[model samples]
Target: MGHRVLAVLLLVAGFVVLAPGTACACSCSDLKPADQMRLSAAVFTGTVVAARQVEGDPAGPTPPIVYTFRPDQVYKGEPVTEVRVASNAESPACGYRFSTGGRYLVFASAEKTGMLQPDPGVPLHTGLCMGNRQVALGTGPVRAGDPVLNGDPISAELVDALGAPKPPSAAPSAPATAPPTAAPASPAASTGGSAPTWIIVAGAVAGAAVVVAAWRLPARRRVRRD
Candidate 1:
């Protein structure tokens, strides 16, 4: 009886040591608004353009949604005109769920990568457990129950720190052209550098009359002297 009890105890101890162990769950002590903003790699306010399932996405609790945003203000990091971020459709995967046409204050990291993601300048991936949160879209005070911001209104310093974002360039205007000039007048329309035939005829008649009068006067004088 004593030998059997010893064998049973030895078997239990060996099994406990050899079996696979469970990994610890992810945990974080929630951070204050300022600390979270400081720790994040990129922070901005933007409007969501669209949401769709990206190509070649990885397996998760739900099909991950890729959100495209047009940035309105940049608090830190690159001032991208457009940014793409991926998060699980369900919040469990730490994905930042985005609604189309909704604006948000996003605190996200671009360190996460995907299998087919293009260059980092194009878009970035954000997930749950990354400490990313949403603040009120406007410049007003942060509302109550905001994940990290709590109820603090936006700081004047933050407003001052916002980078000057270059707006989209307008299309070039078409060149203005002078209306086609009036066609030049023809030679006939001008005097054409020639006198009329009537003037030439009048000059010839006057010269013939003058010559006849001189010949007649000389003959009459000679006859009277003789």
Candidate 2:
């Protein structure tokens, strides 16, 4: 009875030590490419412009690693020129390490409230199990069943599932060119190149009155001489 009790105590101790590792171990289901695309909120091909590990409270959970991407093509969701994706900081948590300047095909999901979000406004999150893989920078045509180039079979599968991708919408078409405003007229041009009609009539009446006064003066002189 004493031996059995000691053995049971040792077994319990072993289980306690192993439990943490088992709980944190990363496991992923074998989902097909199409299924992976469907589950994702946003899918695109981009190059990692920057990457950083977020700092968190020491007593809290591990911080997330964030990658900033310049998207080359968008397969799903609103087209964006730049996107930020956050992931776990360690492999056990399924964090994907992306190198700066390396091109990749990313499958990301919207994480509204979670430890995976490194910042308040970050809209996307990705992991090793999210079907994110690095690809060559070649701009060649994508074909199904080919090796993982920029436009690989996986990308082809995404294209088939979500149709062709479009580039980021251009700068709102420069606000329609503003229709060429006409120049304002000068003060002289606005008056039609003429004086007022009332002023001209007043000048003519003054001249006629001066001539009548001169004629009356001459007649009065002739009458006085007679």
lDDT (C-alpha, whole model) for all candidates? 0.54, 0.68
Tell me the lDDT of model 1 at 183.
88
lDDT of 1 by residue, 1-226 (tens): 5534432332233122211122122223444455445545677677788888744424322355678887766666776677777664544223456778777777665443332132224345554444444555653433334433343555554444333433322356899998999988755444475555666678888888889999999999999999
lDDT tens readout by residue for model 2, 110-199: 734343524534778877677887876743323455456443454455557656776755556555567788899765566796766666
User: TM-score of model 1 relative to the true fold?
Assistant: 0.46
TM-score of 2: 0.66
